[model samples]
Target: MGIDGGIGRLPLAVADAVRTGGGEIRTGAPVRELRRTADGWTVVTDGEVLRADAVVVAAPAPAAARLLAADSPAASAELATVDYASMALITMAFRRDDVASLADGSGFLVPPVDGRTIKAATFSSRKWGWLRDAAPDLFVLRTSIGRFEDEEHLKRDDADLVGMSLADLGAATGLDARPVATRVSRWDGGLPQYPVGHLERVARIRAEVAKLPGLRVCGAVYDGVGIPACIGSARTAADELLTATLAAGAVGGERE
Candidate 1:
């Protein structure tokens, strides 16, 4: 259940496994378009064009729509309608002696009604044993900001965001310590917003895309947004693609 190093190590492990299974992993290659060829698919990127029997479009809804718009208009339109939200994370490191006593738990979430800039905060060093052991004298913490239909705070400067987070931290936990280091990570249109007819829209998209051979789409836009949900959707898409491919081959063999 636990990764050896951290969650960041998962991509490398997955890439290694793919290589072992004779699949290539290309990093930093921006795909330009996906074209349906006579027999399979042609993935056109900035640098090269790769052909494959099956194609899984696992990008965000908008990006996937662009890729499939030419071929699958209905699915692309549905994907285009999927909404997204932006968020930012401000991580700060403070000298343990300078901060006030923290609560026993790892962190806390601020309700929207509180009218605070920070939505939530996590005591990284306290929550993760590995981080605490690595830097015992430093208190590493991060605050999340912005949410669906509320992204005006994200327009502020990084320093201002950090200051707001610190102010909220002070009010919430009575911690009035100045951080020695700070890092701000911004994600634009990061999380998808699932409105009321989301599942039906996803079903329609899947049905439309399934009409085309060797094409499949799956991601947070269609299902749950968590990592586990994304993985499950990917697995299901892969299974369906493989099953259809095998069944077609069997029918062809019988005809021959």
Candidate 2:
């Protein structure tokens, strides 16, 4: 369901796999443009214009829309209409004795109707055995604030956000101890929202993308937003492009 060290490790591991499989993973090069070439796709980045047999654009909807604007305006238009939500995650570390008798569940989700500052709280130390074992003397937990449209709480400063979470935690679990350390991670326009006719919109985007050979797009906007769903979307796009490339004799493999 998740990574032990953290969700961040998943990308690192994927990078390792790419390198192990003789793939070159480039970073720090902001992509300037992506266009379909007669031969394949031309990817112009801050560094250079790289040619590829097939290209997959795995990015947020806005960025993806920009990249596809030149080659597939139809897809770009669809992507531009995709809505998003933002949130901030507050991770706090407390002494083990402080929350030794914390609740048993991994976390609880608060409904928007409740009007709580923190929409959810995850008891990380109790939920993940690896995390607890790694930091035996500390109790770590994460709280999330913000949702689809109601994100007024996220406008506050980090200290203010941390204070709000602490206040809510105290009232709910009687946790009044000060945390030893805290970190705030904000995801602006991160979660893609699926509204009415989302599937039809995605279908149109995919159809337009298919019109341009060697160009494919994937991410939270096209499919489900969970890590597993995103990963699956990437895989599906990669597979589809590879099949197209091989069928057209662009790659070495010959498809039957």
Candidate 3:
């Protein structure tokens, strides 16, 4: 789900859950290297080195491609084949009095024919109950950044993008007030496009990666890019790694 930046506390909730589960999550730690050692896999991030029996890489496709290209050429080639769309989120927040036409349901999705700046808009306050209470004076409007047909629209600067999005939102919701606040975030190579035969490509990648006993890749690029899909891929990768480890141990026991 695309968060409208209204539910500011949701990340805190997620962090608390991780803390409660005794899982330490680190931010700003960039992985520099992943190499196989005699014992297991070594991950070097920043100046810190960590060892694990298995690795599940869930980074974006381009970055993941660079990481795996040297170690597993076939998997890297598959990653390279996957395509992504560049996107930007233009959010404008207005007061309730500013947009009377904004209805109670989710905002509109502009069909390809609309020839408009926004691909979709979610009425932030109306779509989620938690968001409604988060900002009383604020009504959030999220406008999609880029479309397959409209590549030039994404070339605009933040100010231009924000203005275009506001114009579209105003037309759709009949809002006139200048937004109290506007923010734009560009996500380069963000949304993965699931082209025809994408499943076959992903299956081939998985088969190649399976040759590397402890290596796993999981992310929105594979399966589906939805929240559930990412979570499911992560879970499946973990399970597969565990199964492989156990099977290796069983084989070692038999040999012993």
For model 1, the local distance difference test gives: 0.88
Predict model 2's lDDT versus the native: 0.88
Cα lDDT tens digits for candidate 2, 1-256: 6678878898899999999998877888878898787777778887687777788899899999999999898899999999899999999999999887777789899887777899999999888888999999999999999999889888899999999999999888888989999999999998999999999999999999988878788888978998888888999999998888778877632111
TM-score of 1: 0.93
| lDDT-superior candidate, 1 or 3 | 1
Q: Write the per-residue lDDT of candidate 1 for residues 1-256, one digit (tens) a residue.
A: 4353558888788889999998777889977898887777788888887777788999999899999998899999999999999999999999987764877788999899999999999988878888888888998999999999999999999999999999999999998889999999999999999999988999999999999898898888878998889999999999998898897773321100
lDDT of 1 at 109: 92
* Residue 58, candidate 3: alpha-carbon lDDT: 87
Instruction: Please rank every candidate by lDDT, starting with the best.
Output: 1, 2, 3
Among the numbered candidates, top TM-score falls to 2
- What TM-score would each prediction reach against the true structure? 0.93, 0.95, 0.86
How many pairs collide in each candidate, listed in order?
A: 0, 0, 0
Arrange candidates, best TM-score first.
2, 1, 3
lDDT of 3 by residue, 1-256 (tens): 5455544566677789989998677889978787777656778788688877778888988788877877888888889877778888888788878787666678778987877878898776777666777887788778886865456788888999888887887787776778889888888777888999999989998988888878888989999987778878989998998898888773221100
